[model samples]
Target chain A: MTAKAAMRKQFTLNPAALEQLFSVLESHDFQIVGPTIRNGTIQYDYIKGCKELPSGWTSEQERASCRLKRRKDDALFGYVPGADSLKRFLHPPELRLFRAERENGVFRILDNPAPAPKLAFVGVRSCELRALSILDRVLAEDRYPDAAYVAARRRIFIVAVNCTEPAPTCFCTSMGGGPEAGGGFDLLLTEIVSDNQHVFVAEAGTSEGSGVLAVLNPGEVTKEIMAALHEAMDRSKAAFKREVATEGLRELLYESFDHPQWDRVAAQCFLCANCTMVCPTCFCVTVEDSTDVPVRRAERWRKWDSCFTQNFSYIHGGSVRLSPKSRYRQWLTHKMAAWVDQFGTFGCVGCGRCITWCPAGIDVTEQIAALRGTAAPAASDGAG
Target chain B: MNSDTGMKPKIAIFKFASCDGCQLSLLELEDSLLDLVNAVEIAYFPEASRRMLKGPYDIGLVEGSITTHHDAERIQRVRRESKTLVTIGACATAGGIQALRNWKDVGEFVRFVYAKPDFISTLKMSTPVAEHVPVDFELRGCPINKLHLVELIGAMLAGRKPNIPTYSVCMECKRRGNVCLAVSASLPCLGPVTQAGCGAICPAYHRACYGCFGPMENPNPTALAGRFEAQGHADRDIMRAFRMFNAWSWQFRQVSEERERR
Candidate 1:
């Protein structure tokens, strides 16, 4: 889809009037889940009014940087992503399948999938929107149809916001995913600051988006507004400080088994699994069951798993990947270059969550570059 | 013979040095778990069941490697107690990730990672159970392939040999019509040397095989490594690949050491 075709019937809302739009969105009977400063971080949650929004919020992230401070000026989407994207809400960490009930000599399992609420996720960044699309391919596709996720995803609305500022750890440009969302969202917003005006250029892609736009009674998208958005996206793209080349990356990465760089990184990796937890696309899971006090019945659940964990590779008599280096190799090689071969696309959204969230602060881009004779550059810190 | 006609085989799950991934694989079989439990007497699985029944177990599925001195002695007892002992993963068949210490001084590694080396008792190096006891069968994978695990258990139950591929991960990669990461992406893949069991999961997940399952029937480790170098990987990296999980296995050890020397 061309940028315009996916663009919603455009509308503009200045920063002063933005609160009215939030209230308008809240009043329209949709659950408004937007960004808020909770526990010293910008997290997505239900907001009752504009006061709940992180109005003057900004975040600082480095190789292992995480500090949130109020911005000197009001900028809604002026920060890097949190320890989360929208993955947790959409693809829950733990999913329970069905309940087993024994009746009349047969044990019947009832698959109790929750119906997704009419959720309006506000302030979603471009990469996050793309990450949702990857999740779309994994969960809602015709092949693996994750029934539980599909129900929640189908009737939802996405409010995508462009990134004017990029984190030092941010590298969405390399993976071809973000900074400016070209697709996946229902409505796209570009935060604009011109003199005294603080406005968001709004466009609707889906009909559900059209209905939401109509409620706000926002101005029609003008050619000037379109021009402004292009400028904004280009600025966002330029803001990217780190980039990974996805060019012949498949061959460049998948073919090289004897890369010296892996050991250097392996020496640093503790295999703590923080990277996978923060990653939006990783789907490794393990099942656990516990009886609810009454030992007669048991409830089983699937929990998030990371290949970095020692037990993840355990076979009957032993573990297959015996070393930290081996396990780390599997995870890195899979996410960056090999995911394309498996899923016909890159596994990473290039949000740099793995880098920033990693306690070790490993940069996948740096690791890949190292194999190609690129030395590890001096960084303020790293995320693993 | 008539009296034993209907008795189901008793199955016991065991663990070693590795993560609980192998046992978790069996547990992941949500729909089939109850049926599996119904078919076998789950005599013991310390990870799953607390009951430590004395075994002359019909089938013992051993999950890790002999990492500690106690584990070495324990495997001997298990060998005597079980009718069939199938080592589950890389750790059981070849000393696992912990085996990376096989190259370094054991005392140095022990003192480096642990707070007190004196309190810790370990073998000089990690080794697979097969080195200590006769193993009836061996299953390969980082985490044992749940599909293969189920089939193996079922085959034992029905008195037949389990159908497992003895070919390379390369074959499975081709069967799945996966774009050869090496041929297509020039990524450093270990498909040629790694065993076929993981079903090329890393490739399926958009990554190259890291040889989580060790050497296949006849792995051309040099050929794959040579291509990796051709694509710009250093000799240290090539050596590192073979020296990973299955470093002690003669097949992998020889190749990695040769590259290191060069």
Candidate 2:
């Protein structure tokens, strides 16, 4: 049970005049945050109005490639999420914890206060919604809570849009998460059969969601319209081109820790640390202290870190996992097998961002399959 | 390494066998360095300070590989004194770019990288820290991330598990929105096999990775090489690609060996 509970409601939206939808949101005293083109990616940001959104934009993504193209029709929420999830907003890359200043003969620590505001996050995708929940588990943990994260998460609204199209790197289905926002959203919008009438079957999941709906003054939605929306969702789920296998992953990885394959993989691994930076779940970090010159004030801060770095495990007079092979094996085992022992869930979300964006184009799904006992000889096993 | 009676974790950073890029990153911590100094007592780091302290330290960071009898002996001694031993850098991990010599006669490499083998003390192959002792954890990357480095220390200090990824580099590139160099430009990339740590730097730099970080969990290098081949990379080029910084990694080794056979 959480501190707050969800409420439910449903309605239909006019897709052709979606700008009116944005205006309606504005009229309700909600600040709109939605997707817009930025630095060659469809990123979410605070928009001045509907014109700031990528109204006529579409993106092309594959296993190691992505590009944006202009669309023929002016549809506001037509594109899939770019590389970032809502985690970027909730848990920022850089955050200030506290400041230490010397006043009189003593050192004083002042916590950085956060400004909480009511926001309406539009175009929320299913995978991103799941990612947000994953973050919720991490930041909102029992023992040690991330105060900064807690501050950013209060009194927010989520507007989840069903995926009408799937990107090549998407594999949320394998993660048992989605192309759909089942429980983590305030409003779920399914765009179904739009030509003369651009319609979205909207459903509310919280009291706050109901409050937002009451402001929209939207027309009634019948059972037939809801059935059509369900059909649209089914079709979108079938459109995913990529998938990840989560069956028996923990048992297989735990049992195969000493399998010779780790050494084989280590042979070609660069140990670059790219996957950690983009992973939605990796939360390792280190603390540092900054000192104010001419004074005795020092403030400690935490920053993100990875296990792939050479100095990550240095202990005593030496390191235990010295080789890339062993280090890599340790990380792999922990993420898939041991993480379940610790977190009671597999760490992977099957987003496939690690595959499509790697400079080397590493495929995690294929590697897991190999570890699960499908490792054949190298396809180019004898070219030297 | 010096513990200084009962103080913070006595940290020691050591290096051997390869270029000092990873060690340099420690010094590169810049503003974070002072805070790090307060977090742990850096008992022995020739690169950071001149004060040498003797060991039986708490945490020891060993970089580079065991390429000689002396190095192997030194690693054993390092393992003996430390409470926890962590390996830093590629040479100490996948044997660095130098492990490529493990595939060939060391004499050939000696003739290539050095002018005088007569004065050099050498071993048949370069190896990572794990080959020597029991390690508590391992940080990947040619030059490990400063942030990840800090996180690992914090985890150890707190006696908590560190959260590092075991996935591939492709995830990072996508996060940064870098166009896929391999698929879009037909560049040979090892993102499929390499561990995730480097922040997708190479792809951001418009160059494919050379796998300096070593292999991630369950890397499928061969399937990826085939993809490269389909993009018009020749068998020779693919082998060359696999033979870079992490070339000696077995997954890559087998892939290139397959290409070498064809």
Candidate 3:
């Protein structure tokens, strides 16, 4: 049998067996990281087992607000991406490049050398996986490869969950990313909850995943389980409230640079850069050098930057995008148009984090709809 | 002057008509304070030490706002003596929270706050140091960030321009991967128009940005104000948001006036 066929063996894992999967990953010296409720928000952190997952909880997300709500049943991976992402662990917000110390007029530079930690990410969403893949392409380009990113990425083992309950903010379907995970995971899971049973239909995508499955010794994945998995995925696909039409979106954005819609959207944009910050694909950075008062020692560091910032396009004379209209235009057009030219794929994964997390409640779908001259769904007014 | 072979740069810290928060920020650099002392001569800093050194200083770190006639003249002397004049904190960079009085009558404010209103000698408008004298650079924040302060000192010592950003707080928020408090929660945030420095602290804690660091390079406060209006915010609330820490800042002042007109 082919490797793909052999790895495609599926089984139904009960709650106890799922716990064993965590133990198996632990045995391989991988620190298990998963979602947990902390400070009234879903944050990714170190977890011992499935107990740490946000069970019996769901998140209500809208433009600029997120709230954790109680669910009728206990579903571990019921929520979508929170404020945090794989970028935090991989690229990191602040990275020290090197430290320089002047000794006897001779400047000696010491490079920051830290090894990447081996981590097993549990309950990673499909859109997030697509985002990680997008980052992989950006950070691992032949011209300028990030050593830290490559190391962290190589050490990660993803445990993806196919969405049975996608958040209202989700539009992964339109982006051709999700509702169902296609690839880019070590193991994939589909949860099914019936009257008497709660089981996960597990499928291994790699040898490592299959090894963990072997340890779990799950029950046989009968035809009924397969049907349940399909039903769950379909339910998720139907749950998406918004859809972004990507057909000729690149060409449209490129041609409509001066669209009146730009001015309309710019009026609402705070240029606070929350959209770029929360975006899974947005990767801009800035460098800074710091030294002690005596100028004896200095260190260079790199931090995350955004296009929405005036200095991002600044040269010797002045900033390139002086007005909010131009800055908003630059960001949207880059994501929809220039990204395809640069990365060979659409920049946005239609995750809707940008829409839900906007303090102004600016919806990307609505903005795009305006650009396309189509009537969008009435913008959510925060009313139930 | 110490005429040793390795002559460290002479640095001084000055304050005007505001809180001493930014001066405390320099002391808050506990880890690097000793290193800083070793790198430069603290020629004059009343906040840190009592020993006041006369100037012809290499770097003058000015804090607070120009809110009195005495301060208005004092800054000119500071400008003449210092080779490089750097303004630290919102007060020195953009007139700070005290500038809110600029919209109203300062005399009324003096009468309300002080028992002896006639004894108070204050300018009608609280203004930044740059308004009176040329500033080499302006380090922004309510109390400027210690990291940026260190970077500024380091760059000055190295005889190079400091690498301070003119970006919005939105960039810092994104870098930290925090959700947008304004968009997600329908809160009024000035982060888009405010400069990046405070590391998006307010939003991380589920509060909107108050524009403590002032208007970023070429900000559009009118656009953000329109957003606030569309989100069912009252005109007064939108106006109050702009009239906070950086009220007297040109961009915010203009936007606030525009909203009032509307």
Candidate 4:
């Protein structure tokens, strides 16, 4: 089926019908992964059915805080992206490159086979989908693409959900990404909750999603369902507490390299590189070789590296960016500006992970506002 | 002598005033300990082996601090005998937690802790190894990371520089994909100023970093301290945060002192 025809077909699925969707994906040898409550935080983990989703739960996010609260209504996929992202699965923290062993005074290198698990990600948000697209461009679209990432990306499927109830830290609307699904999903779902009923309007983006929808045999879409979808989208768009003007932001950051805002932010910034690590689009890696005694056996491994490190820019003499001020400038500019120059797209997806996960409560949006000579609304009043 | 034999480099391990946790880290290299011994001659290590070879060693890994007059003199001699001297762990690099005496009167501390204060022989301050003798390198951590230890040894063997990172614990926490306790739970974390090591263990388990690895290279503790203040953290809380394992390090020392004055 063509993309246009698949998008034209819309259906409504009750809560029970959603369970059948899970069954269909599992039948296709896809390990279903979705958001679930773990250690008092909503984290994406492996789930068997819709029952494991964080139902009747929502989260409050601020500059330096996140808390899950019991909602009066049941809404799956209510919470936004947590610390884990698609980066965790595609670009793993550590991967073995190769192993070498000595045999008869000669060393032989052996390939470490990649583990490509067939995965179907359920409840992916719009900003996260954008992040996945950015990862595709960086890791898969390049000439010397990462073979492991390519192999993993090829076998996976995406089930995206339109975010109706966005967290306070959310600014996807400003980033031109979401609160509503635009594209890059196999299946898209929007939940409509009213006084006595809960229904999901589902749309397919590919043949695989259409096949899954056929098995469930959902009800025909009506004008009521479309109106509900519009309502939810509008409500979420208005709920955003933060706004970052991205138009010409790349140029503003590049021209304002000497702005004192960098030093001001760096003072409170830990240069911990947590922002890059949690950033779905930030991809940097370092390689190291470990060897056994007698130099008989050795293994090469690649682990996630961040630009916040003093050694990240290390050269023959010393690190180019030595101070926290310079390092923070490098990171912010690279994510917001240099990324556009290098990849023809912004590095950030506006998920606000960096704002919500910073131990020091540093907000990137506020810093950008400061760079623009305007004060960002205080985040100290707590979650709205 | 081993150099003439074309064998592994001779290595020595020494301890002064510490819990010996850093030396214990060497033993914790369960997977690579055997390989390490084969790669380098364990000429002198009282914690691991009974065999004690005299100095003039290729590399000497020193643990602990110079908290006594004898330690101050002995480190000088060790520096002369070893071709390369590396300090490992908090005590060797930043005087460890024992450096808390640097702020107080040692006479009172001895009298408070010991029944016979006159019998105790101690220096007024616990000083890092570099204070008494020049060090080739200093490994940062309360009990240094095993991966870094292995890498340093490998680098020494290859006559190259070790590639240990000098970033804060925030980097490690991000790499580990841990939710920030400071932001998520409003907990007072020292991760922003503390060096990355321990694989961000405390934060991974949902606790704040205790600055166990000391300050990162060119850490901006003033900014972190200001943020803590803005978050409504008490003055004592901010002061205590910087007065942890590596409190004697210049950056942490200055920050803690600044908080105390406030």
Candidate 5:
């Protein structure tokens, strides 16, 4: 790497230069997966270029609610994180482990030969970046690592976007994650849009990122650019009025095992596994094996599982966490407390997916606060 | 009786009171049909074949609900004849849409709708096959997923547990990257309390899942009802949602009754 590429640098980019960034990735045969409008929500999908991005759309999120609305201006990264994150791409919902066939009564196993694709993930948020790091701790560095996850993580290039717009449900600030792109990205972008100009203040976090920017030859970051970046970030930071209160959270949750609050929450909890499925750091998986009777061929598949499912806790005779109360308690305690004991970091990055995607508006942050005795459980408004 | 049917396992398909859509799922297995035929001896299937063989069968795939007094008695004999009695479709598993009569007066309906009410021989309520006989397995869905039927047959032959997930439809929806209609569009969906089997077809096409597959393992329908209420769905509408294909399922039945009371 050149000396200039070795050192982290910042640059200013216009809409045209942003388009060039996509071209650079395309030139290297990277499949660009970014946020796009689908099913009345902004979700991640394969995109050809910035044209496919949800440019003029923004998401309105609340507890158990999300709706996409048209923005006055065409800002590419205007919305907060939706139902998807990098987890969908890195650790897919279903993956074939192996295929086995018996010939002459001798069984032979064949490893799934599907190669991981080179992926360029754009419009990644700060919480998502932390989520990836947290997932790496489980799926990559664990005693028994997931080979498929490792393979998928191998050829990924992240184009992280610093959040300037955080949803009402977002609590990244509480989980030690802020709107700013701290690290774990090749290139970082801070979108600054106004009536006059729509530009991105970009920075290289790696040599490869710098090399990509070198091709575009973006302008030097000016005073005006820094001011715009700071202004937008300040607005976002100020928006996070609520927090999880992580201080002594682990101990609090452990002590509150028999807390009546659990029953209250469970009363409205669907136990549908939506919270866990949408969770970025939830790496729990279950394996299924099926055989073709005629062909004498069998295959094993690993599928994403959730603690919310009764079958998830099944042990021989019956499931351990039988009640919805117990299941909800297990999920919250594990995410906030046990994850720290295991991974040295909390599981939740405060993405608020569990809140926004919950059929019942059972907010985790609110639950934590209620458990802490700082707030009373919201009176069951008769409608959850 | 096919006593000398060689080493191949004997399979029988029986129908009761249903739309025959579940049995059609078997015929819809265009490619797997040949493989299934080669793997098992289809001793009896009235829908597909005229050769009605008696049993002592290995696996009896029963479709539809026990709507008549005759069907209720017939299921007992079917259970005794088959080594493994597997109920297929919502009708046999949870009492199909026909079981909506369980909430109403069946006699009044027979009198009102039929010209010859005295001639009609019917039970007070439509009931699942499991109510009469101990079912070894119950393949769910209004028209059971063909892939699931194939998997069940394959597993029975292999002497292994079928890989049919009892988890909620939300699992499959998330796997398919379907934006939660309940959350995003405020559409009252039964996916949370419903079982996973249909590959989340309804949600994928931008409609709420109507719970055709029946209640999931440990379903929290009351909790889902609360959510629906929060979304401004009327109690009657919420009740009607559960009173669909698998309406007689106890989990869904209890919740629908609760809604009606309100």
Candidate 6:
């Protein structure tokens, strides 16, 4: 499906307006984090201004591979999503839940009182926005809501960008997420960099976004600029090389629970939890309590965890998922099938971070396809 | 809570055939040393106080592997005396780098290196403390993390389990925001199979992990070795990786031996 241009809210802005947008977010006391080159890859980090963006840089990504290459034009959002996602800001890797101290034979429990940082996430893709909402369902909207996640999530201001150049690993088109910006962004942009023109076609999704746009007062969207935006969107839609056939995928995954394909995939899997770590929506966490001997102080910390870990399934007797095959099955089954039952949506957004970041180069799309073809014959049904 | 004697829990440090780097980690805890001393009596640590307090006491921190007949018998006696025995470092837990001799003939090495081959007496294989005696817990790493050493002692005193994670080193590397060298640069790394606790020191510096902390709780070294092979690494290179500090660790040993056979 082509990205429909929001005609009424669209405005054209020169390259300089992006720097002004940074200034606008900064004045409001938002810590701006966006894509920047660090340690030979584009990762989300604190940007001083638009200058910190990885301009004139594009990354080539495949299964278990990503390498940064110089683009012909100096496009800010030229590359696809990096290894990092918005999860790092909203749900931190490590968080102190509370601390208990003993003094004069009296024990006092103190909750963590650190304030959440107001964050303005720049260069957010549509799949990432979906990932944020998925996290919202898990952490904030669940029965026992995470106060920390809710607080941090409430203060975030999203600046979504439409993808013009899709990476080889990206399969967002098949999973109800595409290169176009969706409803969650405060301000959305489609970058158009050609020989004659280099500008951002902007649209405001929220009132605050329109306010920021009004301050910049960009020019009216012209016929030629809109044409270029359509071209970029069409190009991205056509470039998706990988896709998952999502039709009855939830049922297919359940039917293939005993499929031999699991063993084949498990043989290749490292069981390192890299896929879950890089995935934007994987939100499992584990808590640890530590004590300081001399001071008589105890603190509980929440750390990001994965289902792939043995301890993640540890019970009274032993680990439930003892084998690598069972652990891998739990992760994939939960993500594709059980997640729909729990959250009303598949856990994966098809951003392809898992594919590119995995050490074994395991492709989820290929695995799902394998399951669909040669799944163990149903006991009641006819032959495969 | 004190015992009937009204004294702190007695802690002893024992060494077998290690470099004593794990023992040095205790001294490296400069800021916490005084506090640790106050918490427990250093019953028998010849490395520090030269105090040779007898065992049959509390916790024993055993280091190194059983490389000789004398060391093997000593570990069994050490286990019999101590109320709780905890193995420290890769040497004590996974047999250390010296365990590479497990694949070779020690008698041949004695003849080559020593002037008097008859004088030297060593075990055929350098085996871990667990192979000789029952270990209550095992603290991994070539030279164990100073903070983890402190945590182990604190947990023992408090009658609780140590807050050590058994997950892969990749977890800590991702937490530190280090880009995957194996995925991005195609560098052969052992982080995927190695345990956490080193704070991913090697990967942060743009080098591959050498598996100093040993194989994690559930390591897939075979799959990781296959990945290394696919990356165009020679069988010798793959074999060298698994035959490091944790050479005799069954998970790593299986992969290294397979590579050697190939």
lDDT of 1 by residue, B12-91 (tens): 88888988887888889887687677677789888888887778888899988887888888999999889989998888
Arranged by lDDT, best first: 6, 5, 4, 3, 1, 2
Tens-digit lDDT track of model 6 for A93-210: 8999999998887999977659999999999999999999999999999999999999999998999999999987888888998899777889898899988879998888888888
Give, for candidate 5 chain B, the lowest lDDT window spanning 10 residues.
Answer: B1-10
Clashing pairs in 4: A64-B183, A267-B223, A272-B171
| TM, every model | 0.59, 0.61, 0.91, 0.94, 0.96, 0.96
Q: How close to the true structure is residue A210 of candidate 2, measured as C-alpha lDDT?
A: 68
lDDT of 5 by residue, A269-316 (tens): 878999999999998889999988574899998899999988888898
Better of 3 and 6 by DockQ: 6
DockQ of each: 0.03, 0.09, 0.54, 0.55, 0.65, 0.57
- Model 5 TM-score, all chains together: 0.96
What range of 10 consecutive residues in model 6 chain A has the weakest lDDT sum? A375-384
The C-alpha stretches of model 4 lying farther than 4 A from their native spots are A1-7, A375-384, B1-5
Estimate every model's Cα lDDT from 0 to 1.
0.72, 0.70, 0.82, 0.84, 0.88, 0.89
User: Alpha carbon lDDT of residue A243, candidate 4?
Assistant: 79
Q: What does candidate 6 score on TM?
A: 0.96
- Kindly list the per-residue Cα lDDT of model 4 for residues A213-322, writing each as its tens digit: 88888898788877877888888888888879898999999999899988787777777777888889988998977754455667888888888877789899989988
Clashing pairs in 5: B91-B96
By DockQ, the candidates rank as 5, 6, 4, 3, 2, 1
TM-score of chain A of each: 0.90, 0.84, 0.95, 0.95, 0.95, 0.95
> Weakest 10 consecutive residues, lDDT, candidate 2 chain A?
A375-384
Question: Which one is best on DockQ?
Answer: 5
Chain B TM, cand. 1: 0.94
Q: Write one digit per residue (lDDT tens) for candidate 6, span B1-262.
A: 3432457888889999999999999999998898899888889998988778887868899999999999988998999989989999999999999998999999999999999999888999999999888899989998899899889787766767789988899999998889999988999999999999999999999999999999998788998998888888999999998999999999999999999998
What class would a CAPRI assessor give candidate 3's docking? medium
Residue-level lDDT for A357 in candidate 6:
92
- Standalone chain B TM-score for every prediction: 0.94, 0.91, 0.95, 0.95, 0.96, 0.97
lDDT per residue for candidate 3 within B120-191, as digits (tens), equals 998999998989999988888887888899888877666666777777888787676565666455677788
Taken in order, the candidates have interface RMSDs of 16.2, 8.2, 3.2, 2.6, 2.3, 3.9
